[model samples]
Target: MTSDAGPILVTGTAGFIGFHTAVKLLDRGLEVIGVDNVNDYYDPNLKEARLARLGERQGHQFHRIDIADGAALNAVFTQSRPRRVIHLAAQAGVRYSLVNPHAYVQANLVGFANILECCRHHGVEHLVYASTSSVYGANTNMPFSVRQNADHPLTLYAASKRANELMAHSYSHLFGLPTTGLRFFTVYGPWGRPDMMMYIFTKAILDGREIELFNHGEMLRDFTYVDDIVEGVVRSCDVVATPDPQWRSDVPTPGTSKAPYRLYNIGNNKAEPLMRVVELLEQRLGRKAKTIMKPMQMGDVPATCADVDDLTRQTGFQPATPLEVGVARFVDWYRSYHQVA
Candidate 1:
């Protein structure tokens, strides 16, 4: 069932979520044009390997270009003329932004700007970009909702994503470019980022080393699996956003607008405790983790829970993978990939 939409363009196709999304689209028999600089943010080899897997699939194309390079990005969009655009490339990592602020400015800000510009000029029908749960910063809200106010962000990384949402809204309003932004919650699974908690903890535990338990292992997260995130992303991409007819300026909804723009939180509604996640990982690995409990670090949220009602209503998308199953699968992949018993 090949799509008449021609080739789909996926930016940041080498990254974790982007890679999964690109794979899903390719599996659906759509030609995927993947663009990634393959930067060594964590490990370039991992990025290269992910790209290799995508390359193995028929109808998958790869391009090495930084999205911040306006000229390069424009040329790609012009040549590809993709019907849909999934812009996921960015300088990710909250704590890392503390050390390298410019990276966020270049990748998140400039790169995103370049993407929006290209999408606008190229008449992209649907623009699906990745936002983050961190945008709900400093709020005491449980089960974070996309319709809530997210003006206050806790980190440079979160702020950058917030800016992206605003930037997308403007494009949708002015250019009639239907756009959807997904605020992803603590996504993890097989082939996940090495910098993420699950991967770090699993590796440390397998090596008989102590794993740092931030916030004394009392934190909670909506640990959405990569597969579920990919599913939500692909579904959202297929559904074009439309302006909310009921939107009122006096009582504006943060997640919807009079423009053809919408935002949804693609996350597991269940917030699993950090200690429970570790326990599940240990159970899966058949090894005890030496936990080094410590206070929560800066740019860290103690808890995150997503309310995906809007997502469900819009796309009927619900995260299906349980923490235990996801954790077990991650451990299986980690053991085989790292050659650990």
Candidate 2:
């Protein structure tokens, strides 16, 4: 939606999802202020490449600043005077959390607090931030639902995101700031992160290397396409969260409250086996992956399926991108981006 109000501020513009989100906003003829440090998280080159693409678009302003630096982040808010915000910046990676817990604390915790304060003081109409399905840690439910309690986060990354949902709720209650937290499942597509399973498997297979299938390739994941995730995010930004009239104190729901705060699971709503993805990639790439079975690693869930009924009801949208279609698109992009023969 094109807004006549002030520009929309989006954090993590250099990131995979953030880059795609910024493009969506810009294409809609909206002024987009992009904030990103372009850190050496995975590959600064790739981040810069994404930034270069955004720079070509009209109505896009880029700022190189870290969100953890509250002063710098506040400066952006004061200067841009954004009408709304979409926060996607965070220290992502479950295994990386084990090695560097401080990173998660600084980026996810301190950085998020700065964002909340900015929105509170700057009169942001709605704050839509990214959460992860990893918050459903230790819950064996077939399909993860926002109504269910997400109290046991296994990794620091997951715990930090769960904390963001709680932090957003507090702001909504105290300052009347509307907030929406979307717990995303495994998002994959073009311009995907190299650390994710899809990217790693694709690269290794193309290079004639063995692709490790953790948990013996038996894992089921609701692998959402990036375009679908961005659609849900943009729609949530358009629909400001309102207090649930039916909310009760005696029997409170986890996803909604009396305040203008809500949470929704944005996913494909179907769990596909890990091997299914591999097969799709093989078919697209014209090469079979040398598969290696491996045990489950620490801080990883065995399966994830999203219950997107609430998202559908609220946004009139459901992530319906089939795994086969999405994988084929990713492979095509990978080949083009890498300039492979």
On lDDT, the leading prediction is: 2
Residue-wise lDDT of candidate 2 within 49-83, one digit each (tens)? Answer: 99999999999999999999999999999999999
Off by over 4 Å in 2: none
For model 1, residues 1-341, the per-residue Cα lDDT tens digits are 25777788999999999999988998888999999999989988888889989989998888899998999999988888888999999999999999999999999999999999998998888999999999999987888998789998999999999999999999999899999999999999988999999999998888899999888888999999999999999989988999999999999998999999999999999899999988998899888999888998988989999999999999989889999889999999988877887
Q: Quantify all predictions' global Cα lDDT against the true fold.
A: 0.92, 0.94
* TM-score of model 1 vs. true structure: 0.98
In model 2, the number of clashes is 0
